[model samples]
Target: MDTPQPKQLSPRRRRALIFASLAVAVIVGTSLYYLHPIGILAPKATAQAASTTLFSKPDTLVSYNFESAQLGWALAVTETRLNQGPFWIFRTVDGAKHWQRQLVGQTSSLFLTLASFQFLDPTHGFVAVGNPISLYRTTDGGMHWLALGLPYADGYAVTFTDPLHGWFLAWPHLWSTSDGGNTWNQLPDPPVDSTPLFLEFDKWNNLVFRSRLEGWLGSNGAGQPHVYSSADGGHSWQRREVPLPSGAVASGTLRTGVQALPGAGVIASVNPSTSPNALFTSFDGGTSWSEVTPLPIGGGTGDLGFQDNLHWWEIYVGALYMSSDGGQTWNHISDELPSAVSSLHILDSQHAWAQMFFAEGSVLAFTADGGLHWTRANAPQPT
Candidate 1:
């Protein structure tokens, strides 16, 4: 029985075998790392609500959305840890008065700079994080989060109309999910110029859908805006050449913003250089476009919020402006606002929220009285 030992190799051959094994390990590890860069372990990551009592506000507020005045969620950086993510979500049931620590990423060494969150209702929502982007979905609010296994390594934004129907953007590639983020299929690319469309990474609102079959996609910071409309839910698209207003000298790369109105309409904002931006509307679901009115070039016209066809809100030069006559005329409303706002969400005629950045820190301002007054939930400095 002792004579059954395995043969040993020469010293040189043993060293060569060892080196070969190490090379294989290196190749496999690198491939896995590329698949999930920056430690974005989404396949098995579990998100749970954090219990640590940090400051009153978050450190760095990245994204936030609310279904109602009372029910809302905010994603921010609270701490500097890997196992318990610095990216934390805070929820407010009684409006923005007091926010509770709702959830935290459990992935080790997870890193991201920008993030976007949208809540379709109080129960269903999605969050997309950038910098080796990943998407997560929660059906029972933020109580539990399941990492969506997106086929692409990078995701710019995500929008969900219902619990099952949603759209994802990985640059020029657009993917649609019908199984509540469980499975996805890539949609055909629009015939429009993909070069400028690919450069719209900062503008997340460019890709929008009103329903399962209706959607609008546009590009900004690209020369002369290129917008497209789809009636069959992005299976096919038609390019819309938006016309500039008369006597307006087009300068700089065109910055465009598009919003899908509920039902059969869409609105677009075209800002040519430093001139006043113009608003356009299409009643036949982006089939035909017409300019409505010109808004004063106070701030940039990138942020446009509409409660309905006629009621719209815009933050211009630290002031709130409203247009009831379908953006035909603008009226200023007295309110305390910042010179710039990162994001604006208008729930109705009265209830609205804005995320503002200050030299002190970022603050989430809420207005219940239609921009007449505001109460800010100040974010503490990042730890």
Candidate 2:
């Protein structure tokens, strides 16, 4: 038995032996199959079955039949060579897939700046008209517009909690409308040395106001921005200095939009600037502030709106960015749009519309799926 022991192969020889064994086994198996057929050969089919599921086209616009829905309405403006004219009101009861243009009286200058449009319900709404100092209301879902003559001088922004209660602000002045925008009475002006600039109303009816009232008002002034709050419906305002990010100076330009969160006294704003624009959040009811984050794509104007306190969306450079983490982070979702977005309006968390301003063209793109996709609604042909 001791003399019959066989020699063991080395590691390298072992590997070679395993490889040779595998090769021999494969060759033998192949030879056996070819030399003697064991199973019948089936004819090959030329065609394969098509996949049953339908896929959405990546570039196709999501359709919404706005003509059947009561909330469906269009916001359009006629832009001239020199200026953009009054905003045209269009309504579609179905969903926004189709729109019927309404005839609002013509204006002298197409320079009619419409800052904002909002509806408390299907039948009642408010529109902020720029330069001429006018706010229009339509109780019949924009079938006809009635001019609410408020003292207007370059009005920048307007918001309404309901048909009877609303707020509008021009620089240095805050006005409240109790009679459905028919008459807007001015609230107390900022201190003689203070100059108030932007205005917003929160869900709790607290008014959030901003300006350089604490410092200087213009370029020569202190160049700092201030935030003020009024709990008693703009009867009196309390001022607080809003802190800016390190190395960032307060931009004197009026902010584009302000949105108020429901439970958290948080307010958000789109800080306008040529450099990287900022989205700011204020937790203490606009008294103190902090920059949420720099927008993903910089350069174009930015606007902010909230579907709720936790969900936020912003539009800049014709793209939509959504943040579910209260602006801590953002996700870019603007592939469907064709042009840069100049303004955005959110009806709720699911439904929204954006106004696209083409650089050299007169066309506008509208989005319904939180800007996931967009469709070209209307455009003026080139002259």
The C-alpha RMSD in Å for every predicted model, in order, reads: 16.3, 26.2
What C-alpha lDDT, on a 0 to 100 scale, does residue 161 get in candidate 2? Answer: 68
Residue-by-residue lDDT tens digits, candidate 1, 183-230? 989998655453233322334234677888887776555555647778
Q: What is the alpha-carbon lDDT of model 1 when measured against the actual structure?
A: 0.58
Tens digits of lDDT, candidate 2, 1-383:
01221233343543332222111110000100011111112132121111111111211111111222234654444433233333444555444334455433322222122234555677876664433545667676655566667665554346666678777655458677777877778877644333323122111112332221211111112435444455667667655454444456655553322344644645434343534434456666565677776665663325566667768777754467888887777898764543332344566665765543322322334555566765545321111
Q: Quote the positional error of residue 281 for candidate 2 in Å.
A: 1.1
**Candidate number achieving the greatest TM-score relative to the actual structure:** 1
Give the Cα-based TM-score of candidate 1 against the true structure: 0.74
